[model samples]
Target: MEGEEGTQNAHLILARKLFLLTHPDVQDIEKVRLREEVFDAVKSDDMAPLYETLAADKIIEMDQSILDSMRAKIGDEIRKLDEKIADAEENLGESEVREAHLAKSLFYIRIGDKDKALEQLKVTESKTVAVGQKMDLVFYTLQIGFFYMDFDLISKSIDKAKNLFEEGGDWERKNRLKVYEGLYCMSTRNFDKAASLFLDSISTFTTYDLFPYDTFVFYTVLTSIISLDRVSLKQKVVDAPEILTVIGKIPCLSEFLNSLYDCQYKSFFSAFAGLTEQIKFDRYLHPHFRYYMREVRTVVYSQFLESYKSVTIDAMAKAFGVTIEFIDLELSRFISAGKLHCKIDKVAGVLETNRPDAKNALYQSTIKQGDFLLNRIQKLSRVIDL
Candidate 1:
């Protein structure tokens, strides 16, 4: 779980920079500082192509003089790399040639020239012969995908990595892939799949390039809360040692998880309220913040209603620390949308649970299927006679 530092961390920093760029609360001075930091980072890498691209896009002012200086250094460095590749290839040395190509690939990625970086990685992959090495190359490509938030590239690279693993890969790389794919799924709003993947990697996690172990646990808890049933949440998360170790460190995460599972509605609501700002500020979770809030509310309300055949609106409000009117409106909306299996008694100021009968539902489903089969048999007989 070693953290990335120095120039190797440029891409991740750039990804966060992109998020801060769009933050409404970011001050003008912070924007100026951000620009300077980004410029210093790219310039330190001697990224002529990336600098020119930024200047062309008006992300930064063009300094022709500075561009010329970077281009000179870049040209000299790339030429030496090319020379090494040529020398190695002339001697039919696969490993040296692969190393040279990989050096070039990393230079492009460090310079933020994504298309060229991908092209060079492909060249490096061609020189690579081992399945593990090929999977590593795909990991590099996946890094580029996340750096640019290019979903298509990330998706394709993940598929490629999985296929390479099927051809035989080490356990370490496969575990790392789970983290990458889990993050992608979370960013894309597939919380169910993301939760499963994150839970699977909770103990086996070895990669710190994506995030810290604490942050990883935080994600596992949040996603599992919304996706898993109460029983599974208790079994997998509330009782999981990996989660119990770190959940208390993350703000409100402990209260949020335990309050809901313990049926402490007031505490759950308070904890959930405390977490709203964090969710809103998060780059991945912000997009689905409202949907997540609704789902959490649904889960809590369903859990509360499951224990009561009928409950006074006032008592339910007191239980959840909300107004009677508020609970009435909330239950009405959920019931009308068919999300809750209960109805509100506005006239009597109560909520009446009407849980569906499993056996009856199953019987109806079987009768429908049997009717469909009978019709299909009749049609087949008619066809045969014809």
Candidate 2:
């Protein structure tokens, strides 16, 4: 990631390393691999201060001599960067000064120095004249925000980027920001908004620093499935060329998307089973794994049950490729939890759906709104009388 393309995913690597270091489920052998990776990253980036802190925390046990050597190398690099900045300020144009400051900011980012990276990014932003370069600095700040999972910084940067866009911004950066914001929404569990943003950027995705295109498609399809209705799902996701290309590359996602749409309940259930493991391991999705599972099942069950008012429990069980008793228990739990608008007739081995009628729902909503308007009018009348 430190290649000529200049896309530094150092924070993502660091996050993975930290996750592995502290994860209870990470095997000891994996920890060994992480230690090797940690030192390798530190050496390549010359993260002397970071290395010292990790060593002090007993996360690593590198020798003092290695630390001292790294400190010397890092100090030398900082001096050279400072010299470049000074030279740019003394003799060069604004663009050159911006480049120099950006270099320092990127250096701090590469070395996992969060605070310094942000400070230097602001300095770079100050020197940046155009809206595009200023937005680029925001993107860097956003990278650090993601690296640390700092929601406040992320939210403020998103707002600032939006305001900048209002003044002026490029389409490519605007699209990239959508992906960034979508990822933030995913991390925050705002799946509906994330779904919208991901789908919007599906055709224009180029934010490789945040994640690969395939992973982006994966997020797009997953969020789209849960948030979209059948018509919108078919239009935006099931038929979208961008998603169709990579959806098959991700395990079970293709089946997960198609089977539900095609009313292949058994296949949908099978694909969901496989997807559970993938979601459970994903750092972004892990916390919401069980919740997602329940929601997915609820969606699938509602879809199947919506076809008929009453159906035999045995038939429903067969449709889902599960035992009758299992289907009975699932239906009972979902029914009691109000996730499913259905009831079970245990004696008759039947399941009946009782979804609300749309017209009746609209009528009730209208009545509620009328009451609210009447209340407001009465209050206005009382004020006029006073």
Candidate 3:
């Protein structure tokens, strides 16, 4: 019993620390006071009212049992807040009423009523409040953005947050907003844009000692590997010591990088397969699985093609552990995209790699160079009246 009690106490202590870390004051005195109250309740194990308060504050990480309990108790909480709102409206200004609405929105979100929460947010936005209150609203909107899976709304909330941070000269929050924006770009398969955003955010995050350093580095390397060519990746990511250090610490990522650099397609796939589900299901990466797979396959095919002038489709399919039809389709895509300079013979079941006609290309290049020289000389002569 003593050991169990000790474990429970440890859990509560950790929870309190997490709560404090996550719930910043944002210059709102009421919020700071409420956070203190929540901490006190946790310390004292006075949980009944604490649960409702946490729910209304959107601070509780809910389980089904907790959700049911909150549902049963939410109406009373809402009623009490509504009464308080009425009293505030009668005696105070719009700011207090806005706070009440924000509180009510948290309860609505806790109960899975997004529509009501959104309505409350609209009301909150319409109210003329202090900068602190407005910043709090931006935080709330970002929460709603994630809950709703609405990218556009998330982008708008980020913009609001960025504006607030800019006015306050909060460089950390501004950089954090860039990280969020980069993640949004990644989810939409804008790899180049996402890579650029992540790279820009890395220095800011690192310099400020931000908590998302691992995440930023991971995505920076991943996006660069996927989106950039080998030469660009070498220059942009692989050569960067800070990013390389992080990659070295993560074994799977390190292996992936090696495989990519070495053109070991099979090893690269193996490393990718060993990645965590969280990495695989990342909001920006999940949708691009098909495209990424094709890209990897193309890399594998290019390497395979370098060893031979021609190869049987069946042989290629078997080597790659895929069906002939799959290989055929992928090859066609590579050919059409000009990624693989090759021709496929359907009847012969062969892919014939084409070597560039260097003589013809050089002849054409020389002709263009001669024509350019003649044109320039003619222009120079005219200028000199020669």
Better of 2 and 3 by lDDT: 2
Instruction: Give the alpha carbon lDDT tens digit for every residue of 8-126 in model 2.
Output: 37667577677667667778999999888888888787877778888889898968888888778878888999999999999998889889988888888887788888888888887
- Give the alpha-carbon lDDT of every model: 0.86, 0.86, 0.65
Top candidate, metric TM-score: 2
TM-score of each: 0.88, 0.90, 0.58
Runs with alpha carbons beyond 4 Å of true place in candidate 2:
1-8, 56-58, 366-386
lDDT per residue, candidate 3, 200-279, as tens digits? 77665632211245656777777777677777777778777778767776658877777777766667767877764435
- Pairs of colliding residues, candidate 1: none
lDDT of 1 by residue, 1-386 (tens): 11352123456766676566566777778889888887887788887776887788777888989988988888888899899889888985789899999998988887777888899999999999999989888888888888778999999999999889888999989998998999999999999999999999999987677667877888898899989998899999999998888889999999999999999999999999999988887767778889999999999999999999999999999999999889988988899989999877778987899987899889989999999999999999999999
| Number of backbone-clashing residue pairs for each candidate, in the order shown | 0, 0, 1
Could you tell me the C-alpha RMSD of candidate 2 in Å?
Answer: 2.8
After best superposition, candidate 2 residue 221: deviation in angstroms? 1.1
Displacement of residue 56 (Cα, Å) in model 3 is 24
**Model 3 off-target regions past 4 Å?**
1-69, 90-98, 128-136, 155-169, 206-216, 248-251, 262-266, 276-284, 299-333, 336-339, 344-386
